[model samples]
Target: METNRQDFLKKFNEAFATSDVDFILTAVSDDILWTIAGDKVIQGKDQFASSLHEMASPEPMKLKIRHLITHGKEAAVEGTMTTPNGKTYSFCDIYTFNGFKDAQIKEMKSYVVEEH
Candidate 1:
């Protein structure tokens, strides 16, 4: 069960690099809340989808997952994303799921930093 959840989270993060909005939306609940630290707070699946569209880039990002940790209905993934232009950003996202079995993300808090 833990392994499956970990795999799901890995795919979920990879979807961001590929800009797979449909998969992203499908992984979350209707009332999903996302807080991007120092940026903006997104509420609901609709708003989340809108934000993703607004931030879509022509070039796909290269993502490296450094660590993935999960406990109960919570999880955290830390990684670095490198843009096509050579810009790299380190990020950590903490997630809360709706439940333990067949969980869907209920809330997410992300912290991102650009490496100088």
Candidate 2:
């Protein structure tokens, strides 16, 4: 199915809610730039996939989307989640999408606040 920015956000969130690595990977560009806050930044699909693989297990992280907004080819998603280690984190991700109909993510900047 062809996806616009909103559709991309929905699919991405749904995949994330279930911690579906394969499905989530399908929504990212091969050269995607993923930034965690202003500190950690990585490029390339392999690097991102590798990190996700390390995180997901039989019981994966839980994510629940509270809000999502999109304009043009950009989107911002905000949510709360529980990590595998049982830590709670509230997050917001700003995304820029490729012009393709499937709206693969070209760049993502994340901001997260965790309960210590």
Candidate 3:
């Protein structure tokens, strides 16, 4: 369980660093459910992938993980993302997972804890 959480966090952190929809989708389940702080919900892998592709940017971005905690099939993560324009946002993310032999993200909820 511990190793799984660490691996998942690594993948998730990787997802935020690039605008590659395919690489980002690799960490999620086919029926992924994602909700943003703005109350927008993206359902299913196809829809999620499409949304990401549409929002892709050529600018650089960086993600720094502050902390990650997991228990059973759930986890909470804290991090900061620095955008190309030099804006920064600190976020808290909650994730739910359920899989046959290993945990895969089935749902994710994101909240902006701070911004600058």
Candidate 4:
């Protein structure tokens, strides 16, 4: 029996494998809130889906998860991504998933930057 935190982290990684809006929708809550540094907060799953779609537009994005940490309903991920231009960016993201009972992600906040 995997904990909600573990499950969420696993599913999040799976999202990078394909642009499956359904998966994204299922993993997140109806009133999900998502944020990335310097970006406006995305208010719902619908909006999140639309935004993620653009990432896989010309080609699928690749993500490699380096580490994941979970403290109760909160979790964090450190990973590396390859941009469309072949630039690799290593990022560390901290996330909080509410509604542990539902095992659904109520909110997600991300902090990212170029690898240096």
Choose the strongest candidate by TM-score.
Answer: 1
Report lDDT (Cα) of residue 102, candidate 2: 62
Sort order, lDDT high to low: 1, 2, 3, 4
Off by over 4 Å in 1: none
- What residue runs in model 4 are displaced by over 4 Å at the alpha carbon? 1-4
lDDT of 3 by residue, 1-116 (tens): 45767776767666666776776788789999999978689999999998788767687578888888877788888888888888787988898887534667899999975584
By summed lDDT, which 10 consecutive residues of candidate 2 come out lowest?
A: 1-10
Prediction 3 global C-alpha lDDT: 0.80
Taking all chains together, the TM-score of candidate 3 against the true structure is 0.85
- Clashing residue pairs, backbone N/CA/C < 3 A, model 4: none
Top model number, lDDT: 1
Off by over 4 Å in 3: none
* lDDT (10s digit) by residue, model 4, range 4-113: 67666767765654566677778788788888878678888788888777655355557888788888778888888776667776776676666456677788877777
RMSD of 1: 1.4
Local distance difference test scores for all models: 0.94, 0.82, 0.80, 0.73
Model 2 RMSD in angstroms:
2.9
lDDT per residue, candidate 2, 16-111, as tens digits? 756799988988999999999856887999999997776565675677888888877888999988867788889899999887466689999999
**Number of the candidate with higher lDDT, 3 or 4:** 3
**Candidate 1 on 1-116: residue-level lDDT in tens?**
44988999999998898888888999999999999999999999999999989877678899999999999999999999998889999999999999999989999999999999
TM-score of each: 0.95, 0.84, 0.85, 0.79
Give per-residue lDDT, candidate 1, residue 96.
99
Report how far residue 81 has shifted in candidate 1, in Å: 0.5
